[model samples]
Every structure is written in structure tokens, then in C-alpha cells.
Target: MKVAVDQGLCCGAGQCVLVAPEVFDQQEEDGRVILLDPEPGEGHAAAVREAAATCPTGAVRLVDGD
Candidate 1:
């Protein structure tokens, strides 16, 4: 699966980071969501999807076989 995040839309909710730390992170200063793995392995697919689903601002997105 491929991952994408809209930093412009992020509200620093941190749900993505908590759900998929291997694939997401937070900016220390602003608490914005960061995409750690644009193309994480299948092993992290479930977590990635969960992270996206849990995003309060719906900033996380998936494409290309997600």
C-alpha cells in the first residue's frame, strides 16, 4: 500500500503516529503528522489503514492498492 498525508490539513491529532509509528511520526515543534514510510510493507498495511481511519482531520490518505 502507498501512503500520503496532507500536512496542510493536519491538526496534530497524533492518532496516526500512535497507530502506525513505523509509518508515521509527529513534528516535535508543531505536532504535525509526518509520513515515515510512503510505501510501507504489507505487514504494516493494517496499521496504516487504521491510522488513516483514526485521523481526526482525515489528513492521512492511501492509494495504489491500499
Candidate 2:
């Protein structure tokens, strides 16, 4: 799986980081969304999905692999 956050659309909600800290984080100054691991470990798929779901601004995007 791959994850990405849209900086323009994110509102520093931090839901993505909260849901999957191993895969996401925040920029120190503005607290914008940051993808720590674009290709996270196998166990993180659910959390990443949940993060994407919980994003209020729909800034998180998930790309599935074959």
C-alpha cells in the first residue's frame, strides 16, 4: 500500500498521524500532514485506511497494490 496527503487540502487535523503514527506525521511549524512511510509495513494497512477515512478534509489518499 501507498499513502499520500494533499498539503493544499489538509487542515492540520492530525487524524492521519493519530491513526497511523508509523505511516504519518505532522510538520512541526504548521502541523501539516506528512507521510512518514509512503509504503508502510504490512500491518499498517488498516490504520492507513482508517486515517484516510477519518480525514475531515479528505487529504489522505490510499493506493492499493496488486
Candidate 3:
């Protein structure tokens, strides 16, 4: 799977980072979402998905068939 983040829509909620720190992070200045692993391994797929779902602004997106 592939993970992408829309920094424009991020509200510094940090939910994604909380759900998947290995796959996502927040910018220190603005606290926007950051893509740590654009293509995370299968072991992180579930957490990535959870992050995407939990994102308050829908900033996290997961694409299948990376």
C-alpha cells in the first residue's frame, strides 16, 4: 500500500502520528502531517489505514497496489 498526506488540509491534530508514528509525523513548526513512509510495509498497513481513518481533516490517504 501507498500512503499520502494532504498537508494543506491538516489541522495539526496529530492523530495520524499517534496511530502510526513509523509511517507518519508532524511538522515541528506547523504540526501538519508529514509522510514518513510513502510506501509502508504490510506490517504497517493496518496502522496506516487507522491513521487515515482517524485523521480529523482526512489528510491521510491510503492507496492500494503500491
Candidate 4:
């Protein structure tokens, strides 16, 4: 799976980071969601999806078949 973060829509909630630290992170400057792994491994797909779903601002997005 491929993970992407829309920094513009982020609300600094940090939920994405908490759910999938391996694929997401929070920027220290503003707590915005950051994409740690644009293309995470298959093993991390579930977590990535969860992070995307849990994102309050929907900043985290998952692109399947990556």
C-alpha cells in the first residue's frame, strides 16, 4: 500500500501518527501529519488503513495496489 498525507488538511491531532508510527509521523514544528513511508510494506497495510480512517482531518490517505 501507498500512504500519503495532505498536510494542508491536517489539524495536528496526531491520531495518524499514533495509529501507524511506522508509516506516519507528526511534524515538530506544527504537529501536522507527515508521511514517514510513502510506500509501506504489505505487513503494514492494515495499520496504514487504520491510520487513514482514524485521522480526524482525513489527512492520511491510502492508495491501494501501490
Output the number of the TM-score-best candidate. 1
The better-scoring model by TM-score among 1 and 3 is 1
Better of 2 and 4 by TM-score: 2
Give the residue spans of candidate 1 off by over 4 A: none
Which tens-of-lDDT digit does each residue in 1-66 have in candidate 1? 899999999999999988899999999999999898999998999999999888988899998757
lDDT-best of 3 and 4:
3
Candidate 3 per-residue lDDT, tens place, 17-65, comes to 9989998888999999889899999999889988988989998897764
- Rank by lDDT, highest first: 1, 3, 2, 4
Alpha-carbon local distance difference test for all models: 0.92, 0.87, 0.89, 0.83
After TM-score superposition, the amount by which residue 58's alpha carbon in candidate 3 deviates from its true location, in angstroms, is: 0.6
Q: Any idea what lDDT model 4 has?
A: 0.83
Q: Where's the lowest-lDDT run of ten residues in candidate 1?
A: 57-66
Task: List the lowest-lDDT window of 10 residues for candidate 2.
Answer: 57-66
Give lDDT tens digits, candidate 4, residues 1-66.
677789999999998878778888888999997787898887888888888888888888876644
- Candidate 2 lDDT, 1-66, residue by residue in tens: 888779999999899888899988899999999888988877998898899999999999986641
* Clashes (N, CA, C under 3 Å) per candidate: 0, 0, 0, 0
Model 2 error, position 32 (Å): 0.4
On TM-score, the stronger of 1 and 2 is 1
Off by over 4 Å in 4: 64-66
Q: What is the C-alpha RMSD of each candidate to the true structure, in Å?
A: 0.8, 1.6, 1.4, 1.5
Using Cα atoms with residue i matched to residue i, what is each candidate's TM-score against the true structure? 0.94, 0.90, 0.93, 0.89
